[model samples]
Target chain A: MSEPRFALGQRVRIAARDVAVHHRVPAYAQGHVGTVERICGLYGQPETYIHGDGQPFTRLYRISLAQTDLWPDYSGSSRDRLDIEIFEHWLEASS
Target chain B: MSDHHDHDHARTFQPDHTEPTSDAALLGLALRELLISDGHYTAQEELRMMDAMQKASPHNGALLAARAWTDPDFKHRLLNDGANAIKEMGFNLLPIEFTVHENTDSTHNVIVCTLCSCYPRGLLGMSPAWYKSKNYRARVVREPRTVLKEFGVQLGNDVEVRVHDSTAELRYMVLPQRPRGTEGWSAEQLAAVVTRDALIGTQRDLDINAVAD
Candidate 1:
């Protein structure tokens, strides 16, 4: 297992690149910024697993985003949040 | 802007979306046949597994939640190490990581799989059809409050709603706060009000006095 590059409570942005194959990153979360809510342990990347690749564990982080930040027209209260699991490789440090 | 006649005509020719074939069912059948033929597993073993899964329902989760609600020490252990805590209750969740999110007066927790429908099947049985729908998968992360409202869970402005997307290895189940007016109820009686939807965080306001049939 590789050491996680990002720490809990660190701000990170999801990579905006498009992948043609199997991937776990949701299209809605792409290019969005969130704080690492938890270190959800290391696991084999699903993108590689679908291609028959062996276990190449990577840190999975539960990133938390305010609902209003994700959607411009969000109708809920600003206190609402959405947590998405993102692999370490797909996250970039946010400025 | 749309005419009533046009809407009625469109509804007449609507496709039978409910009758769509399940590719997962077909694939499961094929895999089971192959595995049995190859002697990897026998039909009898598969039947036993199916029976076990059938017996696994929301009641199991309700029992656990009822225990947590009555016993503070058990609740602490359940929140700390869910997998081990469930094991103590005779459930063997070996490989799957189980996590319990407690709902309080100020905060509410809901579980969803934005990537795919990953759920705590060992405790709550199979995921509901709505949980796997594309609209839910896409909208819940973006508009959880709206989706939850459709399921009759309306939170106050002061309450924070947190949606947990189970996109990876962890499976989550919400431990809803015990409803009022049920102070002297036993664990079994309390479990009656712990509906499957409540365990999933969609229905929080449970009527504790109603008896299960």
Candidate 2:
């Protein structure tokens, strides 16, 4: 079994990239910094799963980000937060 | 289960768009027929699976939540290992990751599938049409408070709202806080108040009076 890349509460940033195919990372979450809320178990890469390529399991993490930080004009209470599940390959540790 | 099945009727795609049934429905029927004829799966087995899926509803989740609310030890197990905890309740949740997010006075949670309409269909049956809408998938993460407001869930400023985007394999269901004034209610009674919307985290207030309705 492969170890998880990031631990809970660890701050990490989503890698901003433009992909032309199926991916789990949403457009709103790209390049946003958030803390790992939960270390969701490993799963096959979704981009490959759609094409029937299910191998090499990747770690998944649920990262939590403040709504204010995610959107420039987020018209909501500042305490609101958004949690998105991101794969290990799409994240980088932020020091 | 107030016969609110009309929600799916307002979906963007109509069943009679091209023929008597939608293209996707026609394709699904053809695929099922081919699979049965090819000996991949029997029609009886397929019908049994469909019946099992239809039997799954929010009642399963409500029973789990009600049990947890009344039992501290069960609640601990539920929060720590949701899959096993649910299994202990005599339900099999295989090939899917099920996580329970607890709601408290300080924090609230909502669930959404940003990538697609991935949901805990084994436990909650079919997902609401709004949950699979393009608008909901796009806006819930960006403006959860606003989307929740549209759902009539207004959180107090002191309580921080958290939106869980089910983008990957893991599925989430909110363990809504036990409603007040039901202090001595039976587990069956408590489960009666728990609606599908409450389990999905769209609605916070679970009305005991609504149980009669």
Candidate 3:
């Protein structure tokens, strides 16, 4: 299997296609910065939003992000963080 | 567990609009009982919780307002772990540990459960009539921008819309960002900024001007 899309502390951006309907991924941090907190098990390939066509995919990642980086004026403590599940396809290495 | 039935109100979800139904009310009551007996909530707290549900707008806003005013740490935590972090204020999760996703310009978050009304009832008292609507569940993913506009939440040309399909394992809620202009306010004052509609991401938090009116 190809290496996971992101590693711990690696910056990433959510893919444009995964921004469509019927997904579990949240919208706020689509192109946001989050560190790889944990590696969830492989759940087969990316889901085919196209009905009836299941394509083979790679592993997914559970990322953790600080709230400050998410909201521009966030004044909370440093410990505040949000965790989300992103498929390999949804993320791309940040510049 | 086998067949979920509600005598008070019918558990119907209509996206466009809803006519209050006794079945849904009954189902709400039954669900409340389930939470109470399961030790998730107490009788007295349930009454307040139900009242908060009925008084939806301002009552729901209380949590967000509080976060905006004093607990900067909490505001961040809530944005991070939407449901769990709210408990610090004594508001229990309606039942299950629901998923809460914050929506911002870079990204927009919308929620739907294709099969049924699987919401984070713990954080948000009861699913609103529109949330249960098939229109919302079916259309949000297909055409997010238009749907959000209908709800009065217009997205910027630069922002991307992300639809979330809620499931049995995970429920969804939204923590909107704090509005500016309320300087040096107490937590109580800040809590007032958050309305029930805001938590669901249907509306943004009320600003100082909106609060004045």
Candidate 4:
């Protein structure tokens, strides 16, 4: 197993994906840019690829977001903010 | 304006919105009555829970908020370890027992469970109805900003949202930030500023003139 390749304050973008059941990643965030604020310890490997009690994937990074970036026509106070958690594979370093 | 008046007349003539025919209301009433008969709780306790749900005021929360506003050290303690810290301020979080987690800029926290309304009943009293509904459990984690926006919270793109998996023993209560413009205010006045919404993180801490509103 390899250590997750993300850290706090790093810039990243969400990758596009589809699944039938619930997922921690939101659909709207696909391809959107965000900054990692904190690293939430870890979880096992992505269950999608792993099976039979295999080593779990490491989950990390709590990301802060702006309201306007997530939704269009959002005119709320600029100081207002949101935070969310994401896994390692869901993100790729922004160029 | 005639259309408005005619619409109002028709609405006034129709049955009241308070009609008690809804199955949920009937079921809730039945549950209350059964619980009372079974000695699970007195009518007064049940009423207290109802009143808290309606007005959502826990006098103890107000007191703690007031103290925290004035005392930096106490506020730090509460932020670090909420349960025991609140006890030092003279409030108890053990009616049914719960865990309180503070959400911050680095980490956001929302509480929910798909199974049942397992909440921190100790501090906030009983959980609100929406907390248990499938709508909240399903959407909060996936679309936190949208859900919070519906609740009148508008977070910026820079903030993060973290949804917690609340189970039997562990639950959550949101401790909002202390507002500005409350300089030199007494604990009583500060308590007046802290509303029930602040406890659940639905509303931000009260501004100086917020009490008037």
Tens digits of per-residue lDDT, candidate 2, B59-154, equal 999999999999989989888878878999987676567889899988888999988898888888999999999999888888777788899998
Output per-candidate TM-scores for chain A, rounded to 2 decimals. 0.92, 0.91, 0.72, 0.76
> Ten residues in a row with the worst lDDT in model 1 chain B?
B7-16
TM-score of chain A, model 2?
0.91
Off by over 4 Å in 4: A1-95, B1-57, B94-98, B103-108, B205-207
Superposed Cα deviation of residue A29, candidate 2 (Å)? 0.6
What is the C-alpha lDDT profile of model 4 across B35-122, one tens digit per residue?
6667887756655655655553455566776787688798777665566787786555543223444556654455565445665555
The residue ranges of model 1 lying beyond 4 angstroms of the native Cα positions read: B1-28
Winner on DockQ (2 vs 3): 2
DockQ of each: 0.67, 0.75, 0.06, 0.06
- Residue-level lDDT of model 1, residues B80-152, one tens digit each, is 8888898877876656668888999999999899877998886789889999999988887887888889998
Q: Between 1 and 4, whose TM-score is larger? A: 1
Candidate RMSDs in Å, in order, are 9.5, 6.3, 11.3, 12.0
Candidate 4 per-residue lDDT over residues A11-76, each given as its tens digit: 888777886643456565666777886555555434443344324655556565665676665544
Residue range A1-95, candidate 2, lDDT tens digits: 48987989999999999988688888888998999988877789977887786566888888989899999898877988998889999999997
Total clashes in model 3, counting residue pairs 3 or more apart in sequence or in different chains: 23
**TM values, all candidates:** 0.86, 0.88, 0.51, 0.50
Give lDDT tens digits, candidate 3, residues B56-174: 44365365546634666776776566556767666655333445566655655566665567766644567788888989866554455667788788766565554555533455666
